[model samples]
Target: MAWTTIIPATALHDLIGQGAPVLVLDCEFDLGDPARGRSVYRAGHIPGARYVHLDDDMSARPDGSNGRHPLPDPAALAARLRALGLHRGQQVVAYDGNGGFYAARLWWMLRWLGHEAVAVLDGGRQAWLAEGFVLESDDPAPVAEGDFTIAPALVGGVVSADEVLANIARGDLLVVDARDPARFAGAPHPLDTVSGHIPGARNRFLRDNFDATGKFKLPAELAREFAMVLGETPPDKAVMQCGSGVTACANALAMEIAGLKGAKLYPGSWSEWTSDPARPVATGQA
Candidate 1:
C-alpha cells in the first residue's frame, strides 16, 4: 500500500538505504524570505533529496486576486514532477524546517493531482536531525525523466472563495481557519493587509495538532481534538483555510491522519477573500 499521509524519519531512512523508488523533497521555506529555502537546501539536506521551492514549483504567480500562493497549473506541475524523477507508484516524501507546514502543501498538491503515493515527513528535518541521520551538502545527479501525468480532473479536496461564500450564505458547510488565534481574531495582520478571518469561520490553529516536541499527536488524540471543532458536521462538509492556503494543508493532513477524510481546502483563503472589498470579515473570535 502507498504511504499516503505521513511517514516517520526512521522509515524514510530505511527506504533510502534499501534503494526504494522513493523521491525525497526538501520543502524548507521562509515566508518572509522566499529565496532562503533553496539556500538552506544548498548548505545541507537529506541524501538524494531534491529541493522544491514554494513559490516557483508549488505555486503560480499571484494575479492580485488568486491569493498569495495560487495553485500551480496542472500540466506545468506534472512536467516539473517528471523532471524531478517522479513516476507512477513511486512513494514521495516531503519535509520542511518548520514542522510539516510547507511539506504538507506538497503532499496535498500530489493528492490533488490524483497521486496517492505521497506523504509528509512527520516532524520534518527537525525529527531527522534529532534522530542522528546524516545530511548531505551535495545535490543529487539528475535521474532519468519519468512519465508522470496529470489526472484528467481535479476531482475533490479543494474549494474556491466563491464556494466558501456560497457555503457561508447557505449555512450548511463548516469553514475552519488554521491560522493563529491572534491573526484569526483580527489583530497583528503580519502577512496580508486584511486583519480578520472569513465570517462564520472557526479558528483551529495548526500548531495545536502537534506535541511539545513538534511531532504529531497520537491518532486518537487528534480525532478527539478535531471532534470538538467538527461537532455535528460531517468531515466531508468541512472546509479548511489559512493565510495563503499554505499551512491549511497541515490541518487537512492531520484530519486525514485522524481518519476524517473528505475535508476540502480553500486555496484562495483569506488573502483572496480580503482582496475583494465586498466579502464580510469577522474578528474577535468565532
Candidate 2:
C-alpha cells in the first residue's frame, strides 16, 4: 500500500527492511537559524536519508511582493528532485524534529508536483530515535540520478492571492490560518510586516493537529475537530494558509488524514497577503 499522509516509525523501519525502492529525506530546520538544519543533518540522521533545505531546495528566491518561502519554480524543483533520487513511483518519506512542520512542506510540494507516493514520517526524527533506531553521522553515498517527471497534480491545487482576495467579497471559501494563535490574533509578528490575518480567515494552529506524543490525532478525532471548525463548508471549498505557507501544509495533511480531502493551499499565504498595503488585514479572533 502507498503511504501518503503519515507513516509510523515501525512501519517505515519494516518498509526499509523489505528492500523497497524508497527515498528518505531529513527535513529538520530552524526558522531562526537557517544553517542549523544542515548542521543537525551532518551530526546525525536516519541511515541513508538525504537532507533537504527549506530555503535552498523547497523555496524560490522571494522578491518584496512574494511571500517569504515562496513556492519553488516547478521546473527547477523537478530537476532538483531528480538529482535527489526521486523516481516517479518511489516511496518518499520525509521527517523533521519539530512535529511534522518542515517535513509536511516537502510532502505537500511532492504532491503539488503530482507525486502521490510521498509521506511525512509520523512524529518525525524524534520518533525514529525513540523507537531505538540508530542515526548515522556519515554522509550518504552518491545516488544515481532519478527519472522522476512532473505531471498534472493528483491532489489539491494552489490558491492564488487574487482568488483569496476575491473570496473576501465572495464569502464562499473558508480560509483557515495555520499559524500560532498569537500570530493569528494580530500580535506583532517577527517575520512579516503585518501582524493580523486575512479578513475572513479562521485560526487553526497546526499544533492542534497533534496529540501529546506529537503524532497526529486519530482520523475520526481529527474529522470531528475539523467538522467543528469547518461548520457547513465542505473540505473542497476550504483554503489553508499560514505565515509563509509552511505550517499550512500540516493542516492540509491533517485534513487529508481525517478523510476530508481537497483543501487547497495558499503558498504565498499571509506573507504575500500583507506585502501589498491595500489588501485588508483583520486583527483579533475570527
Per-residue lDDT tens digits of candidate 1, residues 1-286? 5788889999999999999999999999999999999999999999999999999999999999999999999889999999999997789999988889999999989988888889899899989999999899997988999988876332247888888888878978899999999999999777878898898888899999999989989889999999999989899888989999999999998998899988889998989999998888888988
Which model scores highest in TM-score? 2
Best candidate according to lDDT: 2
Off by over 4 Å in 2: none
The lDDT for every candidate, in the order shown, is 0.90, 0.92
Give Cα distance to truth, residue 89, candidate 2, Å: 0.6
Error of 2 at 206 (Å): 0.4
Poorest lDDT segment (10 consecutive residues) of candidate 2: 151-160
Estimate the TM-score for candidate 2.
0.98
